[model samples]
Structure formats: C-alpha cells, structure tokens
Target: MELVKEIFQHLNGWGLTAILFIVGILEFSFGLYKKWKLNDKLVDLASILFGKLLMPVLVSYFALQLLPKVAPEYKEIFNWVPFWWGFFIICIADDLTQYWYHRLHHEIPWLWKFHRTHHSAPYMGMAMASRQGFFYTLLFPQTYVTTTLVFLGLGVPALIARGVKGLITMMAHSSIKWDKPFYDNKWLHPIAWVMERTISTPATHHAHHAAHDRDGIGHYNGNYGNMFFLWDVIFGTAKITRQYPEEYGLEEYQDDSWYSQVLYPLVKSDKPGSELAE
Candidate 1:
C-alpha cells in the first residue's frame, strides 16, 4: 500500500500514457485471443488510443493555462482544499461531466458522428474503452478538469483518482465479467445493492452498451454513466436491467475505415449508410 502511494505521488504525465497503453494493448490482445466480439474493429481501437494520447495533453495544457484566469476567486477552493475531499469532489465532478458529454454524443447528431466509433465495436473490452472518435477526446470535459486540478497543485490526487477510475472502467469492460459470482451470491444482496448504486458495475455499464434500438434501444446508445450511477439515477436516464446485452455494436452502421472513424468528425464520410456521411 505504501509503495502504491509512493508511485501515485511520483507518477508523471507521460507515465500515465504508458500505463494506459500497456494495459490497453494487453486488453486488446486478450479480446483477440479469446475471439471476443468486435475483434474486427482494431482500427477503431487504434483511433481511440490516438485520441487519448493527443487530446488529453492538448486540452489539459490549455485548461491548466486558462483556469486561474477564468476562476481566480476560487483559488482557496483549488489551493487550500483538503486532499481527500478535493480528490472525491474532482473525481465525482469528472465522472458527472463525462456522463453528460457521453449522453450528448449519443443524443446530438453531430456529436454522434464522432462518438459512433465507440459503438462501432460489436463487443466490449478494455481496449474498446479507448475506441472513441478523435474529436470525442477534444470535447471530453474530464480532461480539462484534470488539467485544472493539476495546475492547482492537486495533480497527484487527481491522477490517483483517475487511475482508480480507469482500473474500474477497464475491469468493467473486460470480457471476463467479474460481477457474475457476486451477483449470483444469495447472501450478497445488500452489498450488491449498495455497490451498484454507488459505483458503476459491469452489469450496469454493459447494459449501456447493449445493441438494440427500441424505446428500449438497448443498443441505441443512450446511457453513458462512468464511475457513478447516481448521475443517471438522479437525472432520469438510468437503466437497471442488470442483464448483459446478447448483441453489441451499432445497430445498422457502415464498416468505415479506421481512418474514417478517426477523421469523420472533421472530414466527414461520404459513404451511404455512414453516420456522418448521412
């Protein structure tokens, strides 16, 4: 635990990228070896990695540079905040912001052009987590939030929160499905209830990735909560079937090139049936 704390404190920006890359690649490989669904969307996976690499750094830089100028009076909150409280606040805020952006990406046609890359995968995995459109990262609020917190000298705590969040997200997206045993435990009902309400579980998040489209568009891409389900629960967007989707991926979309997925928001696809081209 002490070593973990030390590493968290010492973790550099570049180091975070390296960790995500290594872990992501491993997850990608796991999906490939297991023949997990969506194996054909490797290009989409690569695009997500590129977005994570470039967009976070670019936005974080600008956010850090501009935060003080925009919210100078909030210096006390940013500077002298308690470490744990600041960590919790930032993490919750980050997830809440992400939930909104994710929902909007699905609801708004233009943003969906970029977010479609994520849903393009026919199956879920940690690697799939990175498979987002190039512009998707540009508009991600969490990156800017991290940047602001880092500039405020809360970088360590912010990174720690992100790392913890990433770990959960990665596990939640894994094909392995860790929640099965817990969910099946007859005596674990109370704990399961609390866990599902408090943090995102595989069952909860996977349901978001379900690939159907009715008022129940189980797969139409609406639910977008990250760490917490409360945002969805409170905002009237929560879905709680606790069942995984049998089929995944966009309902009826084109199989565009990875390049198209990366550049679609800016370049726009001209192909018929293409989300952006349409």
Candidate 2:
C-alpha cells in the first residue's frame, strides 16, 4: 500500500504531464489541431498554466496559511486511516463533488457563462481539457476538497484518487478517440458496457462537449461526470452512444475572445451577443 501511494504520487507529478504532452503532440501531428483558432490557443495556454501550475501553488499556500492558524492539530490527522478505505472515501467524494459542480455549471443559466469557455472550442483535444475560466477553475469544489483531505492526513489516498481521476478525465478529453476500439471489437462489448458506466470515456465525455444537442449523439445537457460515469448514471444524467459527436463545442457564440473567456466577469467579452458580454 505504501508502495502504491508513492507510485501514485510520482505518476501524478510526472506521468500526468507526460501523457498529456505526448497525446497533445500526437493530436497536433495528426492535424487534429489545425482548426484551433488563435483565440482557442491563448485560452488553452492560459488555462493550462493557471489550472496546473498556479492553482496548486495557490492551494498549498492557502492550506499552509489556514491550517496553522485554525486547525494545526488536524494536520496529517487522518494518517491513521487505512489506505484503501481512505482511497475509497476520497474517490467517491472528489469525483462525485466534481460531477455536481460540473453539472450545475451547465444547468444553471447564470453559471453557464463561467463554464462556456470550456465548451467553446470547436474540437476535442487535450488542451481543451483544462480550458476553463480563471474563476471557474479557482472555484472548482473538488480541488479544495482534495487539498483539505491531503492536509487532514489523507495525502496518500487523496493523491492516488486524484492521480487516477486525472488520468481518466484527461484521456476522456483527448482527441485520440481511444475508446473506439472497445466499440469496434465484438468481444469487448461486455467489458465496454461495464467500463463505460464505471468511468468517463471519450465517447461519453465528448458527447457532453458537442456543439449542439440536436443530434442524437450529442447530450450536452447531461453526462456531467468527470472521472466516474457512475455519478451520471446514478443521477440519471448518463448517456452512452459508443460514438463521437460530429461537431464539438457550442453551435453559436464561437467569437468570444480568449481574454474574455479566461478572465470572465473581470473582463467580459466585447463581442455583442456573446454569452460573456455584459
């Protein structure tokens, strides 16, 4: 168990970055990124830097400042927890929280603009995985939950759960379409059936990024799971077609500038009729 924890920490630190980099390169090499506009490029770059680098540093700083003054005794407090049990608890808590946070952003009309940047890209790719507004990423509930759990002595399981969830969600957002093999092969249907419901797959997640839900393949209103699809299934938001959407992103309002998309209310879009426009 200790060995597993170390491996997860290492993987989350390096393996996550490596996989996203390699896959991103593949997408570029395959011309999958040819359609990416400059606006999309800037938004993705800022989002990756903010979400990956700054968010962690800020979160750690927050934990350090808050924990010492309020709950010094709680630091590493849950270290006594058995690893697997801790993993199970964090696995359910983190992803389930993300599921709701993600769902609410779409269902709530007022909150939609905050998350609209994520669904503005016209294609499916790794860079778009974290292309959320600054405030949207900052306010993600699961991130704080995981950070708090780590401070509370569940670092091992929290990190493991985070690492595993990170890999699943990122791959699901990649342009590689790796899940197609499962649907193409007859022998894998049973496995695919259980797996699709168990975790977020490219098909299911991509459907949520569809430009319009007019097509039967698109289900942008639902399929809000981040790591686990079980939340969507249990909550009646799941949709599995074993197929990718023909068109990704929003059907309208594609002209939102990168600054407006990333900065949001602090810098609303100048484009008239844009969702980000005040």
Candidate 3:
C-alpha cells in the first residue's frame, strides 16, 4: 500500500504528459484523426493537455491557500482515515458527484453551453478527451473534492482514485477500440458483461457522443458516467451498444472556434446560432 502510494505520488506533470502523448500517438496510428483540420488540431491538441492539466494544479494551489485560512484546524485532520476507507469514500463520492454533474449538463437546458465544447468535436481521441469549456473545468465538483481530500492527508487514496478515474475516462473517450476484443471473443462475453457495466469504455461512452440520439444507438441524454459506469446503471442512465457511432459530435453547433470552445463566456463564438454566441 505504501509503495503504491509512493508511485502515484510521483505521477507528476511529466508522467501525465507522456501518457497523453502516447495516447495521442495511438489515436494517430489508428488513423482516427485523419480528417482533422487546423482548427481541430488547435482545439484538440494545442491547448487540451496544458489547459486541462493546469486545472487540477490551480485548484490544488488555490485550495491549499484558502484551506489554511478557512479550515486551518483541519489540516491533515483526516490523515487517520484508513487508506482503503479513504479510497472507497473518494471513489464513490467523486465519481458519483461527477455522474450527476455530467448528467445535469446534458439534461438542463441553459447549462449545456458550459459543456458544449466537449461535444463539438467530430471525432473522439485523446485530444477531445480534454477539450472542454473553461468554466466546466473550473466548476468541476470532483476537482474540489479530490483536492480537499488530498489536503486533508487522504492524499494516497485521493491520488489513486484520481489516477484511476483519469485512465478510465481517457480510455472511455479514446478513439481506439481497446474494448473490442472483450465483446468479440465468445468466451469473453461474461468478462465483457461485467467490464462494460463496471467502468466506462469506448463502446458505452462513444454511444454518448453519437450525433443523433434517437437512432436506437445514440444516448446523448444518458451514459453520463466517467470513471464508473456503475453509477449510470444504478441511476438508470446507462446505455450499452457494443458498437461505435457512425458519426460523432453535435449536429447543430458546427465550426465553433478553438478559443470559443475553451474560453466560453470570455470569448463567445462569432456564429450567431452558436450556444456560445452572445
């Protein structure tokens, strides 16, 4: 347990950068990004890694700064929480919170603009995985949850939960069909059954990105899980197709600029019909 904690403790910026780059390489090798335009490249690659990467760091920095003032008595106060218990608590709390947060963005009318950038891409890959409006990242509840847990000295489980969630969400958003074999092999059906319901996968998640929602395959209204599909299943939002969508992204909002996608209210889209438009 100590060793695992130490390892995750060292998964710094460079390590995360290497992982995203490697995943980008995979998506490129798979030719998933063959149709990418310059704007697509800029929105997906140029800023995703750095802009999204700073999200957590900035949250942590600001959180740490304010925590000392607001809750100085609670500094490392939760250090006594057992590692496994902390893991379970954070795992359930963080993911469940996100499941609702994501669901609300899709279900609520006005909130959709904050999340529209993520669905603007015509394809899925490591690039799109981090593509989101600035306010979305800024207001993510899990960012505060995990950062608070870490500051309170549940750092080990907090980091593990975060890393695991990241890897799951990344794989779920990836263009690579790594989960294909699980559904293809006859003997693997049972494993596939549990795996699909246990964690987010390309098949389940890609369906969420389907352009048309009522095509018997798409479920843009559901499948809101990130790390754990179990939340969707339990909350009655899960959708499984075992098939990739023919087209990805939104059918309505097209040609939104990179700056508009990332900058949101700070930089609305020029398109009068866009959700980001003033």
Task: Give the TM-score of each candidate.
Answer: 0.81, 0.95, 0.92
Alpha-carbon deviation at 77 in model 1, angstroms = 6.4
lDDT of 2 by residue, 172-271 (tens): 9998989898999999999999999999999999999999877798999899998899999999998888888889988785878899999999998889
Can you write out model 3's per-residue Cα lDDT over 25-107, one digit (the tens) per residue?
98898788876777777777645765656765888676768778888888898899999999998998899889999999998
Off by over 4 Å in 2: 1-9
Local accuracy by lDDT, each model: 0.69, 0.88, 0.83
RMSD of each: 3.8, 2.8, 3.0
Candidate 2: worst-modelled 10 consecutive residues by lDDT: 1-10
- Residue 175, model 3: lDDT of 90
**Candidate 1 residues 97-168, lDDT tens each?**
898888887888877777887776777765677777677766777877677777766766787788777666
TM-score of model number 2 = 0.95
Off by over 4 Å in 1: 1-42, 63-77, 213-221
Task: Sort all candidates by lDDT, best to worst.
Answer: 2, 3, 1
